[model samples]
Target: MAYNPSPKSKAILDQAWDWIQSVEYQVTVRWVFYRLLQDGIYSEKKGYRHLLSLTSKARKGFYADWRPWTLADDTRAPVLVQRQGFYGLHLRGHGFQDEDDWLARIKEEINCPLDRWASQPIYSEIWFEAAAMQGQFLHYANENMPLLAFRGDISIPEKWRSAERLAERYQDLGAPIHIYYFGDYDPKGLLIPASAWRDILAWTIVILNSKGLTKLEALESLNFHR
Candidate 1:
């Protein structure tokens, strides 16, 4: 009596599961549909309609709970007259250092001013076009993996500022930053992958230069949806 994902549905589910496990977050229904189109599982014309049907069927007291999940909000749309499901992701950092030790010892050393950034290892980051994707696509693949990040469809002033500050803090460490982005294929969507990286780099230079950290450059990589 339970719903089993057909081969077609399973293909999309596989991607979602991978993303959810890697990024330690859940995927929104919108994200699922968009990703399906991106992966060529469904044509634009068919993907939207197909996903809508699948999700609708899932909401109608389907046997399989994971077929379509919805967070509980009595006032929210897609009104759930009955039933609920459980999903979880585990993505805690593996750092052994405790907060006390960080403040009492390593904080100053790590935060100290530096002169160059060439010696540091390459850092990689990932961004998704949609903000909701942040949960399942923002973190690193593992604790040892390079840094990963994300932003909403548009820029956020605080997020940018925070990035700038981090860049300044590590200016002398010589780490090169790389970024990977996931998004739609629209005119604006295509530009964001590159633009977001540039904005931070430019801001980093300005802010670090203000602090007298001159003659420093961070190698960076930016790739986005086509």
Candidate 2:
């Protein structure tokens, strides 16, 4: 069914669009809902469904000829495998003479930059509780630095893998790991990092010990802060 917004909803959408543009970043619908509540443009705690419908319609161009993806939901996006031959076709279209020219261009294109943190004494990462902010965080994050979003409380296996990665990095560079965490200041958000810190430390010690390192050595090798 097609969505037809009431005049009040249309005004709300215009306000939402203005706010979204002001931020200069794609935000989630939940973010928009909360913003409306904070701005007094909306009330009624259970009215989220109505707001979501209006936003969806606006994004799909059911109201005005609006841009499609004004609101973002990175988690729900489809993943697709990249096509390699497109590079060759693009080069040819750009007046490349032969395969040698295409091959040279492709080689340079595929040659990624040197490691950004090889000589640094600290292996740094950015962590957040909401996956929706991944794109925004990545916009300013340094190359080769890990970015992790827990999307709520992180799982045991995920923490184990994180520890393994940190252990491997410590073995390679002997650097202390630093995590610059970004999340809500709520009680649950505060607890997430605290729990993760304790668990990751224990997991890192276990991983390093299996490689014939002592507990004291493991403790010395692994360093992390939230």
Candidate 3:
């Protein structure tokens, strides 16, 4: 059934809709509600009932179709850059249209690599893990760390590429890989670490076995710390 928002609810929805149209990226319901409150749409309405009503209406196409804002299956997103004016990008090995010049640019300009493989070599035994804490893991909040660190979710398959790389590096270094982990003590929190370690173990085993290395037990020196 469609949500029939009241006139006041529609007014709130319209205001949020206007803000959504003005931005290029997706905006959350709470974000819209704050803007509406800031604009004095509702005088000091602390509750979320009206906001919920508007969102319900939106989801049902009563206000606006919510698919664009909510239908993302992959966690990866495009990297964005902000600047005051236009920025030009081309693969000439040169900055502009020059017939003879190839791949040469001013010294001050930052060069963009043509290769897709961007990860560099590492020589560290230390690794960090955040059990389902995406904010700390994938630099979701831009928490910077070395290449050996990573974040894991309920299913570790998504992080398998990283796990495989880490295992390869550890094997080459002939050192035990130590994972320093951060996880909540709650129900879901406690389980993520164990599950993550299981996948990591599986990934490492596959990499080692493929390499035809001996001392499988000695080579796979992986451990997780709280």
Candidate 4:
């Protein structure tokens, strides 16, 4: 008979999932676990043990039952594995005119409220070159809803400038300032979200899977243990 995850393991997994979805938390499994352990959300020993056990199960083919993985298979590690399962592998094609054009599209998609005085509009988009695996993102806001913006190939400096300018413009018009990015899954991709939104629109930042339409099904496959 196969060993079942304990209730404690289930609790850890649930907490891990919530952290994974948090805009304030780092998107990597290492960082997530590190922060969780630091916050007393879970003990370091328990967290490490759970990850090790999951890894062992994966190696023995207990999770999938057909193919065995190695202990060195970093991709199967719990938190990072789940993050990859959630965001990686969904490649997106590039289709933005330029930075301004990209920003305009996001504003339109999320409906920026530059004309409003109370709240701002929220908007978000993923930018990537499907063929090359190079990708990035940006976000912006208006008066009514927090408008998230994204650009695939832009630089960090440029992203900052854009966000500042957008905020200034919205504030001048009596609109609330809001903006953020849903970053890519890897380390480099991780920096994009961190740099683009940092303190200005920090509350709105997120890490999202950019793989569009047809790729959604592929995403679903990652959830399957077998």
State each model's CA lDDT, in order: 0.50, 0.73, 0.55, 0.40
Across 146-221, the per-residue lDDT of candidate 4 in tens digits comes to 3333444343333444445443443344333333334457877766555434422321111112213133332322
Return whichever of 1 and 2 wins on TM-score. 2
Error of 1 at 5 (Å): 57
What candidate 2 gets wrong by more than 4 Å, as runs, is 1-79, 82-108
Predicted candidate 2 versus true structure: per-residue lDDT over 1-226, tens digit per residue? 2457788988999877777777866687778788888898878767777887787656443356543346665344343333346443242224556989868877778754676778997778888889998998889887577899988876544666788888887777777777788888889889998877677787677778888878898787665555
lDDT ranking, high to low: 2, 3, 1, 4
Q: Write down the worst ten-residue block by lDDT for model 1.
A: 67-76
- Which residue runs of candidate 4 sit more than 4 Å off their true CA positions? 1-4, 24-26, 45-49, 55-226
User: Which residue runs of candidate 3 sit more than 4 Å off their true CA positions?
Assistant: 1-73, 79-156, 218-220
- For candidate 3, write residues 1-226 as lDDT tens digits: 3456778777777777788677877666666777777898756666456675566446434245452133221344444432333345543343445733433444356567442222424233334445245434456422334434344443233345546766676665655656666656778766776766665666566667777755456344666676
Query: What does the lDDT come to for candidate 2?
Result: 0.73
User: Which residue window of length 10 is worst by lDDT in model 3?
Assistant: 67-76
Model 4 clashes, total count: 20
RMSD of each: 17.8, 14.9, 12.9, 19.7
TM-score against native, each model: 0.36, 0.51, 0.42, 0.23
